[model samples]
Target chain A: MPSDVSAPVSNGKPGRLRRLIAARAEGEALRKGNLLVLAVLLLVAVVALLPFYWMLSSSLRMPDQMFANPVQWIPNPINWASYPEAWGAQNFGRYFFNSSVVAVLITLGNLLFCSLAAYSLTKFRFRGRHLSFMLILSTMMLPLEITMVPLFLIVNSFGWTNSYQGLVVPFLVEGFGVFLMRQYMLSIPTDVIEAARIDGASELRIFWMIVMPLCKPALVALAIFTFREAWDLYIWPLVIITDDALRTLPLGISLFMSGYGTAWDQVMAIAVLGTLPMALLFFFLQRAFIQGIAGTGLK
Target chain B: MSPVSSSRSARPGPASSGPKTPGRRPWLTPGSKQTAFAWAILLPALLILAIFRFLPMLEAFYLSFTDYDLISPPRWVGLQNFIDLTQDPLFLKSVQVSLIYVSCSVIPVIPLSLGLAILFNRALLARNFLRSAIFMPVVMPAVVMAVVWTFMYQQDGVMNTILGWVGIDPVPWLRSSSTALWSVIMIGIWRAVPYYMVIFLAGLQAIPRDYYDAAKIDGAGSWATFRYITLPLLKPTMLLVVVMNVIVAMKVFAVPMIMTGGGPGDATRVLPLFIYQTAFEFFDMGKASAMSVVMFAILMAFAFIQVRLFTRKEEQ
Candidate 1:
């Protein structure tokens, strides 16, 4: 992992030897400082992860043992039934299917449309191009609150209330996705497209056969982001859809608390369940999530 | 959300013309017939934005001036909702509470994230694990966090249980009107800091090691190097993090809603929840639209100023 792997003293003459000792002293001090930083960082990490740990620990405990006075980190007897019971009681299978469908649809929609828009913008010569782009950017400034009334009206007019189309279609075209794809495509060498053009490849053919193949990383990043956003969306879904069967994971988890009036065990169980898919996604492809964030250049 | 500034994506390709044509390929000019393909690609997003985003904005602005209940047709009563907002004590308090929430969440996040990121950057062991752990909360749904946090802050909850070990009396967290807002603020911080830290970590990585090495060669101490070199370069990132944090904090709703329902007595009510209550719970769409317009204005002002500042800095 070292950027330059040569030893402190590649040439060990007398003066070089003395300088090496001095450099070693500096290295020692730097390591010492880094150790202090590492200790503090580990402390913060523990604090940051404490809730997850507690949630996991509590989830495995007997229901009655959850709030036992002088709470023990390790309960006397572990209980695993809470997982299955909570899953059964909360209609989690249905919620999971709903979340999965929404997330997947949104991801697919974003990947397809965003790349097409990106391709056209990067590869075509069109009028008012900048204005169209500016219009897209301008939408980012409008708070969702301002759009709520009209959106609600339009959805109602379409009779899309309590329907998946209402939830998914409006979000299929994301400005951010278009923006990210454009930025990435800007970096793609124009020669490839010209070569494809010389071969008489159509625009759609070039996009699919050439650009899309090269945009895998950006597409993966966009997919992860769209999935997470769709999975966690709360307010709009809450406002538009009222049917008990139509709630997303977030709404479903919250409903568990409100309906049963906050049974600590049940809430914890559901929270853990709700967090599982995304958490596993993070665990396995943390690289993709980090890449997604960095690729967006927002960080 | 701001308008989709997708300039990079929608930039027109260079004109295609023979040398003889000499800038006369009018078809190839941007925003003309030739670029219809690009516009076609952008069409779906543009259509959705028009219908779902922009149309509602205009409608909301129109509604804010009237006295419309959802059941009854909106009646034109110009500025009544605004007047009602001005006179409404709860609305005033909500505005104040929202400001407090934004200020509290935004102010502390930068320094906290910087400190955390610097530590993580310097750490040699368990670096990846620690980073993932810190960033875990960022992806956790806010509703889940609220549910779990509400449990932890209960009178006999885990937090008070820990407090008991320190001989501190049990403190009502979300239940007490006075403490509820602050409690929500803590959750906001806890939930928010990790995201900012991830950003700061990326910024930290971008800082070239040669600068630190040069500072070291000059016999500069750790603090001097950090103050003189690190802080200055990180300023741009710090500004970005603060602006984004404030924007996210301003939209905070699910956290407070699930945790306290805006209170023991409206103590925790902020604008979004307030808007929800006004529009849905009370069925007063007009008054709700007024609050929405106010929120839209505040956010727009913030975004405009922020984008200007960001672009200005970039230009410099």
Candidate 2:
């Protein structure tokens, strides 16, 4: 009736009205389809985050209630005692310090050394330049897992075991970092470097002042990547650090878990503490982090 | 490849800019100076790599052939370690375990990650927040992931509790030999799916929007559009994800090491974890190095494919 009231009596009126109904149906279907997609994505996101939520909830629950029937999704009288107990139980303060020192040094070293190598590889023409680049790229196959035996022998020979140098030195400059920096620097215009060169600016001056400033995004990406890898280092430190005082966070947590397997609250607490720094870093630098990964893959 | 190589060759000659009197300052040629500066900048990194990466690689190869136990000097026994490995049941079992882990984990990762990527690629509300939430697993430290997962996989843990709500009997996740490796495999998929999803999302975004519009005009359905348009354009990204997923899966260590410690039997003893135990716990460096050489070969095959893929892309 409404259609009859609104419709004009013309030859094309029925056909136009039919098209209008079809388009409306299609639009409604599309809207429903979008809602379905959103729901699916939200479910996946929840599934992905469930472990983290469990970690937090377990950390806050009392020891007796950890295995309660129906599963305490939320702790009623929240136990905040686990944090200090876990931290003090294994001298975690020292472990955090060790992790911080090692991660910072490794990050700085990669940013400086990888950028320098990348700059030379990209912007400069010299003999054996391609050879060097190829050789560096080939190192991708030689992950620490395959090389740890000889590396341990080499480190022990240097008497570097149980020292920061053992953990930090071997990982200072990664092949992946060099590759990432090279890929990013390839997009930097050659004229800019040449113009600075023509002005009689020293190479170091040009690198420090002109080139490095233009590479902020790549640098940030490299820094975060190196820092995360260094912070999460487990195998190398497990092999090298026998001294409890020198153990990094991963080593300390593993040892703590083994020693106090029954203390679920404390174990979860250490897990949360160990994960906090990286979570915070990612939270703040989410855009750069995602873009960095996407850039590497797309490139 | 041709463009990059040609650009390298076309760099301006330093001879074009020199003092009028060439013989007076032969050592000060701009070309030589540039070379020197480049080498100076590259020296520190090259030195570090030479010491840490190159030397150890060579040492690993050499040590595989020689019997060494930190106390005694290495004694060369040609092919003996390799021969022993052939007869070693644990080593063989570990290889099987690693193969199973790699195939099972890597296979699911490809489709699941791509599916997630495709879903996220759609325009929707709170997309960014949802993406960030899914990405949280990636930023969790591997050690913490191992610890938290070990907690969750316990008999009375949350994982079993949730299954009960769905009217399913609780399963022994990491306890029995039958399910231990599978449990570790599940964790591997959980962590890796999010990472490779990001990579796949990048690949999806790289696809030109015009293709979809054209497909729609041709009356193509959703499945057909994905099959013809999306699949063909996503070939390179698919290769990258497969290679990277296999590599990560092969190198999985921290989880099994912390969770099962190679298990109640040899259920979850992946190659790397077995190699560690052989070298450190068992003090058989020669055999361990031989195992490393084997891993190196497997990884190199994948790495070779990756390099070819990259070079081919460059040529295009």
Q: Candidate 2 docking category?
A: acceptable
The DockQ value obtained for model 2 is: 0.32
Per residue, candidate 2 scores C-alpha lDDT tens digits across B82-192 of 999999999999999998998899889989999988887754567778888998888999999999999999999888998998998988999999989999999889998
Query: Candidate 2 on A80-142: residue-level lDDT in tens?
Result: 999999988998999999999999999999999999998887777667777788788777667
Candidate 2: C-alpha RMSD after superposition? 9.8
TM-scores, all candidates, are 0.88, 0.90
Best model per DockQ:
1
Residue-wise C-alpha lDDT for candidate 1, range B30-148, written one tens digit per residue: 44443666677778777877787778888988888888877788899998889989999999999999989988888888789888877766425666777788788877878888888
Cα lDDT for residue B159, candidate 2 = 89
What lDDT tens digits, residue by residue, belong to model 1 across residues A258-278? 986545666688889888988
Q: Give, for candidate 1 chain A, the lowest lDDT window spanning 10 residues.
A: A1-10
Tell me how many clashing residue pairs each candidate has: 26, 0
Per-candidate RMSD, Å: 7.2, 9.8
Task: Tell me chain A's TM-score in each of the predictions.
Answer: 0.88, 0.90
Interface RMSD of 2: 10.7
Q: What is the CA-based DockQ of model 1?
A: 0.36
Candidate 1 to truth, TM: 0.88
- Kindly report which residue pairs in candidate 2 clash with one another: none
